[model samples]
Target: MDDIRLLPATGLEGLIAQLRSRGYRVMGPTLRDDAIVTGEIRSASDLPQGVGDEQDPARYRLRKRDDGAYFGFAAPAQSSKPVFFPAEEVIWRGRRDTAVTPDSAASASTPDNAGNPTTAPASSPHDPGFTVERDQLDAPPIALLGVRSCDLRAVQIHDKVLAGRTYIDAHYVTRREATFVVAVACSDPAATCFCASMGTGPRPAATDPATGEPSYDLLLTEIAPSDPDRHHFVLEIGTEAGRDVAHAIDTAPAEFDDQHEALAVTAHAASQQTRRITAATVRDDLRASAESSRWEDVASRCLSCTNCTLVCPTCFCTTVEDVSDLTGATAERHRVWDSCFSEDFTYIHGGPTRESVKARYRQWITHKLSSWEDQFGMLGCVGCGRCIAWCPAGIDITEEAAALGRMRAGGVLPTGDHVPTGDHVTVTS
Candidate 1:
């Protein structure tokens, strides 16, 4: 039902070249600092070969695989979140005060200066507002070479918040429009992964029922370990732009053979992961069980370090800080990533709204799992397991969700103000 092609594994460098020739800077997973990290890549050799990662709650380790497959691992710690919505970006620069003259003062007198030079004072050349100019980050058009299925879904979830109506992030839209996502079917899912249960991935498909389109421009399924000598990659075109890139690569019509079937079987192993996050009624049930003792229990372990939110691909909470030099002549407004886990995130003028870690933890988990659907029309988590893998307290979101389900099923945790007492958690699991 789709245009499929066979790109021989040996021809991967050619494919990279094809994308680069089309004005794309490739980003892919590579081995760095004993961990697999995303880096700008030029060729297949730049990718992590013969490498696989073992990820569990609060732990991750990279090890050599028996085969030299480029995408034989789960997603790296950093996803395309940093690639698209950067961790830190300067929105615009400003000046506290500027030299003012009689001309400037006359122009600033009224909303419309009615001056001979220009109608609007802000539109004038030396206007103070004009001093605040958008900083040109100049990020090149990117092509993510080996994005995993969960990570791809995370990008789509971000699209709802950043690109959807009500508000649009100009920076995010610019990078997103120019980017070409090449998603890879995940054959190896970490222990913390539950994208299957979340209805996100194991395989990156070009079409979906809810969204009505693919999360990526091209979907790749690697066929290997069965054929010792021949490693083949089958790609499905999702967009016209993707077709253009494919045309540049040396590809043959993909054959529906045993090797192709083997790739599916390998990918299915990720879906069969023992760890599962139950999606049915999770939203409504989580909202009902907000006062459960599980919150206190989890908060006891939670250090409020904010590692979970930082690693989460879809969490987009940010704060703007006005920075100035010693003389205060020059200033710049910096857009920085913020986390709900921080007590000061909800700080009022007097003091923090969430004085205790328990309340802060409650706000984060509830907003992400339950209320996010109402706010964004989709679940916040794509089940990439980054929150679980990176949480210093090793607090598993799936386990916490499961606890909520158990509590609600037994007897709805008292639906009133939160009490610090953790008595109900003992009977939960």
Candidate 2:
């Protein structure tokens, strides 16, 4: 690891300008209408500075903070995947036309006289022409600012699935490969986050250096108790590109050994506030409980709107369709996002594999918590709790999982099995 650099607040604007000048699109959190949204940002002024977000199930709002702290909040309502595999995309186009025949006179003139050894010229014949072309898209190099650590880890997991040896997603790789991640240490985490239990969290330990195989280029940690006039960022470079980008900013060398380590500990401690599920039995339990009564209870309140899958950072299922204009001359095939919660998602030649709402809900949860490990070598969920926080009915996944565990354990569920003890954790902000 390189020495930390002290960057003043104004240095942020310079960094944005540098990125834009290098032909890279700068995407970061910004205050939109009433919430923080990720989009193209041209300068530092575009950031959601001094603002915090209040997120709950089916709702998200922005609130003013006393301190003008930038990047001081939890995950946003939307994930960053849409930037790559968009919600909708055109896959192909087709046109229909009839074939044309050659002129009769010309054909007659092309007849050969075998006896006389004389042959006439061949006539030209027109045939139907159908052309198929793939859509050409280039993934521009992106500089992502203020990315939370959990989402950063999510990106890593996505790379493993999308760019793994077995199958490489051409679309995802084309757009996500060359991204420049500027990870922001979480100064404030939501009550719903359980990254600590997962061994990934608000702050990553410097001792466990990010593996260069798939590591962030730059990492930024905000020094707390910052005032409007005096703010500091502990910047560390992880790659050659990161070094180059850091050099562009007017900064001074600073020692962050103590502060950075303390922050990492604080972040880890904060993660304990979340309920922990024993991953040991999660897989077997999910497979065994596929037809359990707990699913029926969950499905009763589920609206089948598919909000959970949509907000999830890892769900990547999609569907395609073909549409033609009213004139019937032009047509296009499009690929769009889909969810297992939807009734049509399980459709087959005859009908859907899972007919009841209970079955669909069972499939989704089981896949996420259990089957995913067998399929991808990692859990599908990152414990972000977006599903619980965004579900219209306020359905808590941890609560439901605990309840099912009790049913499976002969009606004797372990107390505080997944609940936060409030002893190992502490929150400063």
Candidate 3:
């Protein structure tokens, strides 16, 4: 680990100014219409300070925290995924045109006007009847502030799926490669969080923290209460770029001692309170429960609205379409984000294979907890709990998984020869 730097809390504004001067656009969380949103920010004042949010299925609202801590909150209702994989983008364009040409043999036999035989009248290829073009967008370099630890881990997971092997997403790579991440440790956790069990949460720890394997360029640990008079920020530079950014900011020297270490320990412990499952048996347990009937039980109340996938930090499935104007003179192909829970997601030549609601629900859970490892060498879920919190029916994934875990332990099947767990279970239509 490189030597830490202490920056005056107000120096964050100067940092943003420096980045902007270098032609980078800064993006951070800010209070917008009673909710925290991520967008272009020019200075520290544009950030959400001392504001928190309350999130539930189909409901999200901002709240004021008494401490006035800038980043004292859990993950927001939105994730930064859309900034890379936009909802819609043009992939290709084509045009329709008609032209006349003489036969090759006839043209060869013809002579120039000066000789004898006049050449066939030529046509301008550039003067096409129709044409289509893509809109060029110059994506400026971005610096993300106040990113949670779990979401930072989720970004790595997405990188594996999108650019890990032969399949490389050009769109994702363009944005990801140019962006800089500034991660902040989670000081507050929500009730549905289980990042601890997934081994990706609480505090941002590299997959191999002891080996000094760093995952972020900059890591900020909120050391103490914010004081307008004498504000302090403990900054850790994980990479060369991070050190440059820190050096550019005009701030005080950071003291690294036993006190700062103790503060980090306290923050980690506070994060663990919301976690129910421990690291043990999370992957294997969820995999073994794939064939169990608990899926059908959970699917009963599922509306298949796909809100969970949209708000999740790591979900990246998409679909493409070719469209043309009414005149059919020009056409364009576009790609857009998609969800597995939607009916059109599973459509095939014959029909949708996972037609039943129960099957759709089963596929989603099994994919996230079971098959994701086989595909990406990591668990699909970071346990941000967006899926649980955004389910309109209040279907809790952690609760459902817990019920399955109990069934697996007792050697009973959830669907056959077992009783339902609670009143939340409803009969399927």
Query: Of the candidates shown, which would achieve the greatest TM-score relative to the real structure?
Result: 1
lDDT of each: 0.78, 0.70, 0.70
lDDT of 1 by residue, 174-291 (tens): 8877788888888888887887778888876566434686667777777774465878788777888878778778887766673466467546766557667677678987889767
User: Which residue pairs overlap in candidate 1's backbone?
Assistant: none
Angstrom error at residue 30, model 1: 1.8
Number of the predicted model whose lDDT against the real structure is largest: 1
Instruction: Report the lDDT of model 2 for residue 418.
Output: 39
- What does candidate 2's lDDT look like per residue over 1-429, in tens digits? 355677776788887888788778888887768866677788888888888776655556678877767786677766676766677888878775643344533455444667564565554544445566677776578878877766776776777777765878677787786788777777676666666665556665332223336356677777653576667677777677878888988777766573565377446546445565556677777767665667656777788889888888888888989897785566788888899998899899999998788788888888878898888777777767678778888666666665566557764333323323222222222
Task: Write the number of the candidate with greater TM-score, choosing between 1 and 3.
Answer: 1
Q: After superposition, how far is residue 34 of candidate 3 from its true place, in Å?
A: 2.4
Per-residue C-alpha lDDT of model 3 across residues 1-429, encoded as one tens digit per residue: 245777667777887787788777777777777766677778888888778666554456677877656776677777666666677888778787643233422444457568675665544443335556655667887777777777878777777787666979877777777677777777767666677667776777744332344677676666554556654567777778878887888855556572376357436745555545433555677778766777767778889998888888888888988898886667898988788898888898999988977778777776777688778766778878788778888776666666667668878764555356463421111
TM-score of each: 0.87, 0.83, 0.84
lDDT of 2: 0.70
Error of 2 at 354 (Å): 1.4
Which ranges of candidate 2 are over 4 A from the true structure? 97-129, 204-212, 256-272, 411-429
Worst-scoring 10-residue span by lDDT in model 3: 420-429
